[model samples]
Target: MKARVTISLKNGVLDPQGKAIAHALHGLGFDNVGEVRQGKVIELDLGDIAAADAPAEVEKMCTQLLANTVIENYEFELLD
Candidate 1:
């Protein structure tokens, strides 16, 4: 199975990178854009892991290494 994890800042957290992106977009004539937020995507290959256990396994990975649980939130999807 393969897993895709998405990590993003929680609400009310400062996102300087996202702010920079929004500023750049506005400078490039995308004035209509508003409130941009940025996140990261991680793809993992779990060889031979059963589908039933993938969620818990991936959640452990996220909490342990992939994300900073204090300031960020994560969600994942498993793919065959």
Candidate 2:
């Protein structure tokens, strides 16, 4: 099975990198952009552990390694 994890900054958190990207886009004449938030997508392949409590394991992975829970939130999906 394949798991895709998305980690993003929570609301009210300041994202300087996202802001910089948005500003650069505006300077390139893409003025229609409203706002931008940066995040990460991590894909994992589980060999034998795919069938059992995968979501919880993935959440643990996010909490322990993939994300900084202080200012970030994560969601994951499993695919066959």
Candidate 3:
């Protein structure tokens, strides 16, 4: 099975990197862009894992190491 995890900052959190990217876009004549938020995607190859158990396992990985869980939120999906 394959899994994908997305990690992102929660609402009301300041994102400096996202801000910088927005500023650069505006400088390049893309002023139409609004406030930008940044996130990350992680792809995992969980070989031989059952479909029913993949979500829980991946979520555990997120809570333990993949996400800060303070200012960030994480979600995942499994693929066959």
Candidate 4:
């Protein structure tokens, strides 16, 4: 099984990197883009431990080590 985790800043949070990218895009003549937010994606191969509780376990992992819940929000998808 494969798990994909995505971590992103909350809506009200400021994202400097994303803003920079947006500005660069606008400079390159890409219009109609309102805002951009940067985030991270982590892919994990949990070989053989693909159970119904996997999503919760992964969420726990994010809360415990992968993400700073105080500023970022995390979500995950499990694939077989």
The most accurate candidate by TM-score is 1
> Residues 8-64, candidate 4, lDDT per residue (tens digit)?
998889999999999999999999887999999999887888588788889889999
Candidate 1 structure quality by residue, lDDT tens digits, 24-80: 999999999999889999999999998999999999999999999999999999999
Tens-digit lDDT string for candidate 2 (1-80): 88999999999999999999999999999999978999999999976784678888888899999999999999999988
What are the Cα lDDT values of the candidates?
Answer: 0.96, 0.91, 0.94, 0.91
Q: After superposition on all CA atoms, what RMSD does each candidate show versus the true structure?
A: 0.6, 1.1, 0.8, 0.9
Q: TM-scores of all models?
A: 0.96, 0.90, 0.94, 0.93
Kindly provide the TM-score of model 2 when superposed on the true structure, using C-alpha atoms: 0.90
Predicted candidate 3 versus true structure: per-residue lDDT over 1-80, tens digit per residue: 99999999999999999999999999999989999999999999999988888888999999999999999999988878
Model 2: worst 10 consecutive residues (lDDT sum)? 46-55
Rank the candidate models, highest lDDT first: 1, 3, 2, 4
Report residue 12 deviation for candidate 4 (angstroms): 1.2
- Top candidate, metric lDDT: 1
